[model samples]
Target: MARRMVIIGGGAAGIGAAGAAKAAAPSAEVIVYTAFEDVGYSPCGIPYVHGKEIPDFTSLFLAEKQAYADAGIDVRYETTVLGFDPESRTVQVEGEGPSGYDALIIATGFDYKPPGVPGEDLGGLYYVKNIRRAMEWDKILDNVRHAVVVEASPLGLEMVTALAHRGIDTHVIDPHPWALGELCDPDIVAPVQESWAEMGVTTHWDTRLLGFTGDREGHVRTVATTDGELPAELVVVATHKVANNALAVAAGLRTGSTGGLVVDDHMRTSAPHVWAAGDVCEIPHGVGGLPLQGLTGSHAYAQGKVAGTNAAGGERAYQPVYVPWGMVAGTWMIGGAALGEVAATALGVPHVVGKATGISRARYFPGVRPVTVKLLAEPRTLRLIGAQMVGGEGIKERADFLALAVRKGITLHDLASMENVYSPPIGALNEPIVTAAQAGVST
Candidate 1:
């Protein structure tokens, strides 16, 4: 009998899993089910689209339905999987009926979460996470002269930049003093705030949104926050998302502390033949073994591969999750892990931070952007635990090196002694990582 593989969700994770499963067992019948019209589109690019960096909404997609069919995989679009019976190994799809499966892969990612405040259901409120934002937001986005964005995540700042670029009076509000709160340290944050001010982005630090008020037409007009009320035409909320785990919870799968499905390295759930991936599952943190949500697109695809491969009778394990991320907002660019003094204090780890700035190119070379590097190390062992930076470019790549160092438990001395490839047109001869490493060791 041919094995049957059923995948729920058509996001990056689900798509990656589907491909891997088919490759692992060509004779197996593979099916991918999603409730969305478009499949394999990048969610991370939504902010860029809203910012007008992307040319069109259609450009975000990776493949079309024909491509999936040509590969001998079944893609059931606009299909919602409501429930599954583990005993019968069957899944019930909306309007399509129930189907039996030998193995099940659940990649139903994050849900659209609202900022738990009053009057959130009002009109003119937009969410960057929703797919409809890309397909339909254009009709109303033109009228948004003044936009109030409520969020604490780094993506919120991205939205602030996108909205500000559209010549809208953009105001970003959060209860925290700095944006990218846990990711970037104060050293990187200071320059960011100054840049935000220069970009005409009003920052409402240490303020929380209490409620929202609208005009007679029921369109959101006034932003009533803890600080005060401000006039607004539109409100965009880009807050953190909760995992979509209703199916897993109903199916009696064990959930981790991260509020996502608990899975081993192979991404297998508590059930005998069930697997979960993407934001709906939790992976271990690189620094500490604590299970944390792997919310990035890169993570979703990679983890999905592991889950799918294993479910298809192949052995593959997911890797430790670390974010080698960068964001360009307006004229400001930020890179690195953003875990420095604050993270160490919160985690109760005795740590020291070393900071240094190196030019992106030689002094004589043109386009010499300043790259800042902050290295966090254990005071006792001098092991690199985290790093943060703010630079024009070529910084996040350097942060990836540090991320590897953190993964390998590399010592500061080891990093400082490593040879840094430097060219006059690219960066300083010394390299910021080695400089930061030396500084961290001395501290």
Candidate 2:
């Protein structure tokens, strides 16, 4: 008999696992169960849909139900996996029918936590974490004339841009002193705040939302913050996310200190014959050994591939090699443990270097924006340990290259002598990465 593998959560990770498993074991039966109505829709594109940058929300779906069926994968929609049984090696699924499997893969992804404030459950409050919420937001935003977003992360910034683009009076509130507080230094963040102002997104920095006030209809009317109350027709909370590991925890699967499912290099959970991937699993960072800040489609696909291949009698380990790239409006931000003062503090390393801002392309380039680059290195050794960049367009890619260089322990002198492609329209004759390395060397 052919091996039967059951995968939960029909998002990017699950889909990739199903496809990869089928390829590894041609005779095996692969099944996918999803709680959502649509499978393989890009969760990252929710903000673009809100911003009306994408013409239609449906365009984000990489695969439909029919596509999965055509690929010989059984896709069970609206089906929820209640829990897993390690001894029986079966998953208890809810809705429609029950099933059994020889191997299991969990990829339930992540969930958002709203601010614990009174009247937050009002009708006008919103949180977008999935496709259903995104569609619901699209419908309600047609009637919303003003909106307030609480948080200043990339998602919060995206929400601000989306509301402002629709001509809605938008206000962004965050308790942090600046937007993307942990991702970029204060020097780099100042210009980003200016860009937000230019885009007409009002910001309330260093202010926390106390509660919400609702009308008789249970619709939010005003948000009460530590500073003052602001009138709002809609409220969006873009706070941090909690991993969806309830099933894993219930099944006695090991989880990380950070609450994500703990898996091995091969993506296998503590339970034999069971594996986990995507946002639910705490994967390694690209540069340092630190856990990734969050999950992305690229990581999910890679993790799923390794998990499925190993489960199919093949030996494969998931080796992560890329950092996450976050884009808000036109601005790009990349995060990784590139030996900055903050990162060195987190890793308990003594490092110091100077930071600089320059153009990725020539100053004459029409669309060029200031790129802030911070370099971290051992003062005595002069070895580059980390680097971070924030700007528009090509900045994220440049930051990624720097992250790799740091991971390889590239020296400041080697980096300063590095070669890069340059064009007046594309990049500067002296790349910011090299320039930043030279700056560190001089320091």
For candidate 2, what's the RMSD? 2.2
Question: Positional deviation of 377 in candidate 2, in angstroms?
Answer: 2.3
Query: Over 4 Å off in model 1, which ranges?
Result: 130-132
- Tell me the tens digit of each residue's lDDT in model 1 across 1-443: 99999999888899999999989998889999888876788878887887889877778878877999988789998888899888789999888678999999999998756677778878888876556566577556777888888864767878888887787888888888788776667678677678778878888889988988887888899899888887888888877767899998998888988789988999999988999999998888777776777468888999889988999999998777656777786576877752567777888878887888887778688787887888888888888888888887786687677777788888889988989777897767888888888887777
Q: Could you give me the TM-score of model 1 versus the true structure? A: 0.96
Against the correct fold, how does model 2 do in TM-score?
Answer: 0.93
All models, RMSD in angstroms: 1.6, 2.2
The Cα local distance difference test for each model comes to 0.82, 0.78
Using lDDT, give the best candidate's number.
1
How much lDDT does candidate 2 score? 0.78
Q: Taking the tens digit of each residue's C-alpha lDDT, what string does model 2 give over 62-171?
A: 96679888888889888778887988887787753556789899888887766888997898888776788778779888888778999987688788888888878889
